[model samples]
Target chain A: MNSAAGFTSQDSATRISVGDALTPEDVSASSAVAAEDTARYALMLGDDCLILAQRLGNWISRAPELEEDIALGNIALDLLGHARFFLTYAGSAWGKSEDDLAYFRDEEDFRSCRLVEQDNGDFGKTIARQLIFSFYTHELYSRLVDSADATLAAIADKALKEVDYHQDHAAQWLLRLGGGTAESSRRVQAGLDAAWPYVEELFADVEPTERLAEQGVAVLPSALREPVLDRLHAIITEAGLNPPEAKGAFGADRSGRFSEHRGFILAEMQVLARQHPGASW
Target chain B: MEETDRNAPTDQVPEGGVVTEDPAEHSVWPLWEVFVRSSRGLSHVHAGSLHAPDAAMALRNARDLYTRRNEGTSLWVVPAADITASDPDSKGGYFESPKGKSYRHATYYKQSEGVPHL
Candidate 1:
């Protein structure tokens, strides 16, 4: 809402204050398109966080160590927070609620990337998954905080802070397991190799991604790829390790394909909701 | 900061029976104690413990294990073995016996519950 910071020209012409900036009239024809685009992008992001939160949540009372169980639980809560904001925004565009977006949508209708839905394989694999996703999200959120849409910018700004902690958590685990005993180092490297092909999908330029970038509703994932890779390289170097080259063929439509791992993951994730209709805790 | 040149050996088993062993022989890492300062200009308070292979990794593990949800702004990690405590057997004779000494108590001379003469 502070025009001088990052508001679009179209937004600036309509209002002078934060509250006024969100008024219906201030959302221009182009801005409405941006909001629609924002909704779609938010769903994609919300699904990523939701799925990852589910995966991390499963680690509670089951982590390799007690300390790690609590740590992973906290990270899951942070991701859930991000999911809440993004899904709330998505629902707002359609005159719905966050609960409707999260509960009513079918699995096929979900827009998350496949990486998040893949099962939490091993402790090493989970850390590897977190390392890749957190770094990617951190870069995206950093650039997205400067978005032209006020609500999107606000969400991005808040998420960026949370994602920084998430990235640091993953980075620390990566260094520890990668540089430690031979078995740990080997296993963690194997996990990275398994996760690498999915990493490329994260940067692939897709239609929704392109449209959202044009309207200033989302940061282009491709633009953030370089910095994310550079950071990964630095962490790997610091850890005295190398990620194995990615194996397996690249799948089409990164968002469309779920690996062999997702079935079990979804069964566990959706079980409680499916079992209890309209249940409140 | 320069790495402190500790006269203390990096690999020796401490008096308390805490020892570091190669990963080939031992599966678990040595425990490290964590301290966190919640914000700038605050004293570090004892947080918890975690395990890691070395000091750098220990510090990192501390960050992840202790400060995940913005609970801390700064962290300090020390191998749990490095900390020395006075013996519990000595507590009764050495610590508790000294508590009642008149000179040490600040409240020995009580002030009235009013604006006191400075």
Candidate 2:
């Protein structure tokens, strides 16, 4: 998701398009936040959006149909919008710019969940990933509108509207693919089974998460997981789909363990930059 | 919602009209028409239709299907059949006449210095 090539420029204009169309000025308005704290919070939220956006974008021209292709593209756009806000916030913390943070970061520098980095396996797998991520995002953004951090609050306020639509999109598809023809139902079940192991990693509490949670600059992913899973369960049952059985943690890392699939995804994702260090469009 | 007719149970819609039932009664969903308005100055325009389990799902589907293109500031989804219309082909019975109300024309308005634009 990081694009160092795109970050080479220093233009600040892209960061603050809010008043004209989409504004970053709201983020520029000082919340008087501590620089390091702001950077951590920004990276956390920004990486989440960016990684998810990348995953969804991979569906372009590969979805089951044209409508789904367009739908996933639209969802990716919304997530990219959110990533811009959070990365812009991160940039402001260091007196840099949004593109600087997005395109300049290394893989180790990202704070997104390992689940998001898993490769898209199939249509069912994509929806399974979306069902988990969209539910988490919808609730997180809904609570974040009231965050003490003004910039975070503003970003959340705007994004909550978009996420509301995203949640609906995932919910309907989850129902259809889960409850549809026998073939679809079986694949969707398999998708959820493959995806479920990574879900727990998203909620694993890290020290950075704990620190930001106290500042009201970050919502605790651990605290939100229960409600997220509850909602997921409700939707699955309503759709006549069985919840995938929980798999034991695959990694003992603090974020739990990433699935074996992640290395391949990162390899593909980072290849362009690795191959051509200074490449530009 | 496009699914209305599909989702409607045996009694939901009269047979042979939008919904038909097999003995199983496992009708799919109902279809609803979608409308959207960009702002106060704009009239609601048809966006698209979708199938959903109920009204709430219909609205949600409409929002996803139509508004994701940034086409609307607001949305409305109504069961397609709920919309009533007069048959244009049968309008000859009473549609041609204006009831002879000459005042309905703008010729009655006169321009004056006090009402320059009018």
Best by TM-score: 1
Per-model clash counts, in order, read 0, 26
Number of the predicted model whose DockQ against the real structure is largest: 1
Relative to the true structure, candidate 2 reaches a TM of 0.70
C-alpha positional error of residue B60 in candidate 2 after TM-score superposition, expressed in Å? 5.2
* C-alpha RMSD in Å of predicted model 1 compared with the true structure: 11.9
Q: What is the lDDT of residue A208 in candidate 2?
A: 74
User: Any runs in candidate 1 off by more than 4 Å, and if so which?
Assistant: A1-34, A243-264, B1-26, B38-42, B47-53, B56-73, B96-99, B106-117
**Over the stretch B46-87, how does candidate 1's per-residue lDDT look in tens digits?**
988888767876776677676654567798998888899789
Q: Residues A1-281, candidate 2: write the lDDT tens digits.
A: 12232332233643311222235554655464436776677677778788788788989999765556777888898898899888888887677766566665655566777667767888887888888888988888888887778777888888887888788787888888877889888887787777788788777766576777887878887898889889999998887788877864666232314445444555666677767766777
Per-residue lDDT tens digits for candidate 1, residues A84-113, read 778877776887556677766766667777
TM-score of each: 0.76, 0.70
